[model samples]
Target chain A: MDLFYLAISSTFVNNILLAQYLGHCPFLGVSKRIGTALGMAAAIIFVTILSAIFTWSTFTYVLRPYGLEFLQTLTFILIIASLVQLVEIILKKKSKALYNALGVYLALITTNCAVMGVALLITRKELGFIEMLVFAIASSVGYALALLLFAGHRERLQISAIPKSMQGTAIALVTAGIMSLAFIGFRGMAA
Target chain B: MSKTQHIGATLKAGLWQRIPPFRLVLGLCPSLAITTSAENGLGMGLALAFVVTLSNGIISSLRNVIPGKVRIASYIVIIATLVSIVEIVMKAFFFPLSEQLGIYIPLIVVNCIVLGRAEGFASKNPPLISMADGISIGVGYTLSLTLIGSIRELLGSGSWFGLRVFGESFEPLAFLILAPGAFITIGILLGLQNLFSRWRGEKFIQS
Candidate 1:
């Protein structure tokens, strides 16, 4: 029951994009096409989960035992960048379709702060290993949910007759604003 | 491009042409994350300015020595080192602000703006010119972030920098401070910017 609440709260109440705003760069940038949006969402989900696991292990076993918590940011970034590279290489060799779908988004995952934010939030919240995994999964799901919804809106936006000055990013941003306002409805749920 | 023109153009480009956050839209991570308040935004901007200028200078100075295949990795290492320095210094001197900004201060290492500048501008220019470019772009980013921060802060709190600007009548829109507020505020600001630029273009044509 507690785990269920955690999942729900993370998905909507404390949404990674709508609530915390951890990953707006990709949220706005890659949501133009549904295919690429889904691809990016999957990439973020994979990277966030793995990053949280690795960061939790490293923080608990390596950094804490040695009193090197200060190295958190640097070490996490190095790990994430290398991990993205490894994932890209493995996907390319093993699954051509997946590789083609993910394509440039795999490289982009390295810089997506949402992945790092999850790791940090998990540690800061002091979740155990299992709880950390749950949180990671939920956060990524939330990210994907927001990305796909935005992509849908953007697809329609491409055909709509928006004002000349509000075309492109300007209009997309305003639509995001409306989406964000809609997300506010989730705040009433029990966290 | 001619040498003199190249230097002059590069310096000018960072100010508006390649404005880090607004024009290039390269570094949205920090732009959205840390601009929750004017103070946080200023602190982040200053720290980023320092890192960008120093890293750009060093990268430009050592561009020839770095191997092409491994340049990105090398650049990350250098940036990580500088970010570590800023992180430590901030923690030591400005504990309160440091605590408020949280993991974001160190996360600056991964900020695409700094890396983007290194790869796009710094790597190609001389040290002095690259440093100027870095500073100009940094200023542009700082200006944009501060602008966003002030707008959010003012609307969210009915105060500018915590001084109540609007009297008791103003019931600060709670959405401006919330997560959705960031998107709405930035979106409107972007739209207004586009509108102004178009208006300016029309004026130039008429004149």
Candidate 2:
């Protein structure tokens, strides 16, 4: 029940993209197509879960023990970066289908702040291993959910004529504003 | 090349030509989250400047030793270290501001601007040039943040930096400081920038 609540809140109430503003770059940049968004979502889900566990355990065992909590930022980032690369290589060797699905996105996930944010949040919230894993999955799902909606909107936008001045990010951002407003309805469910 | 000209070019490029928010659209996650008020924006900007400047200088100095494959990791580590220092300093001195900025301080480790500069400018340039690039981009980011923050704060609070400008008759539109407000403000600013470019007969900045 605790893990379920955590997952639900992370997905809806405190969405990393709309509510928390963690991964705007990729959310905006890659959400132009449903195909790309789904791919990115799959890769992010994979990476976020693994790194959340990896960083949480490392923090609990090594950094916290040695009073090197200050190194959390440095160590966690390095871990995420390396982990993304490792996942790519291992996927390529083990499962061709999975690697092909996540190929480009696995590389792109290196700088995706949502992955790093998951690690940081897991530590900040002081969740147990199971809860942390659930939260990571939920956050990725939340991000993926938001991305799908935006990608659908952007896809529709391709056919609709927009003012030249508001063509690119301006229009996208305004849409994000509306999406943000919509997400606020989830606040009643907030913890 | 002349020293003065090189420094001037870096500053100009960073401040106006390739400003992070409007121009390059880098480091925007931080901008969106922290620009609730001018004060928070300024505080976050200062923390970013301190981190970006030091990290850029250090990365530039160590560029030669870092191998090709692991350079990105190294840059992030150096940036995270500097961000940690700034986090501690901010907590020690400006407790309230630190509280307001919250998780963003440590998240600076992944801020694209810091890593962007380290990889793009610092890794290739000398320490002096990289330091200059850092300061210039920092100033550009600070000005943009304060600008966005002030607009949101004015609309949301009917005051400038906590000073009431309207004589109590102002019922502030509360949405201006909310999550939507951040996007609205930046969106309007970006649109205006595009309109200005079109008016000036310049190439439209691609988002």
lDDT of each: 0.84, 0.87
Q: lDDT tens string, model 1, A1-191?
A: 88888998999888888777777678878999999999999899999999899999999999999999888877888888888899999999999999998889999887787897888888789899889999999999999999999999999999988877777777776787788788788878856
DockQ of each: 0.54, 0.74
lDDT per residue for candidate 2 within B122-198, as digits (tens), equals 99999998999999899889999999999999989998888887777889989988898898889889898888888
lDDT of 1: 0.84
When summed lDDT is taken over every stretch of 10 residues in candidate 2 chain A, the lowest stretch is A101-110
Write down the TM-score for model 1.
Answer: 0.93
Can you list the residue pairs that collide in candidate 2?
Answer: none
Steric clash count of candidate 2: 0
Docking class of 2: medium
Mind giving the per-residue lDDT tens digits that candidate 2 earns over A1-191? 87778888999989899989988888888888899888988888888889998999999999999999878887888888889888888888999998997768888787888888888878888988888888999999998899899999999877889988888888899899899999989888768
Candidate 1 iRMSD in angstroms: 4.0
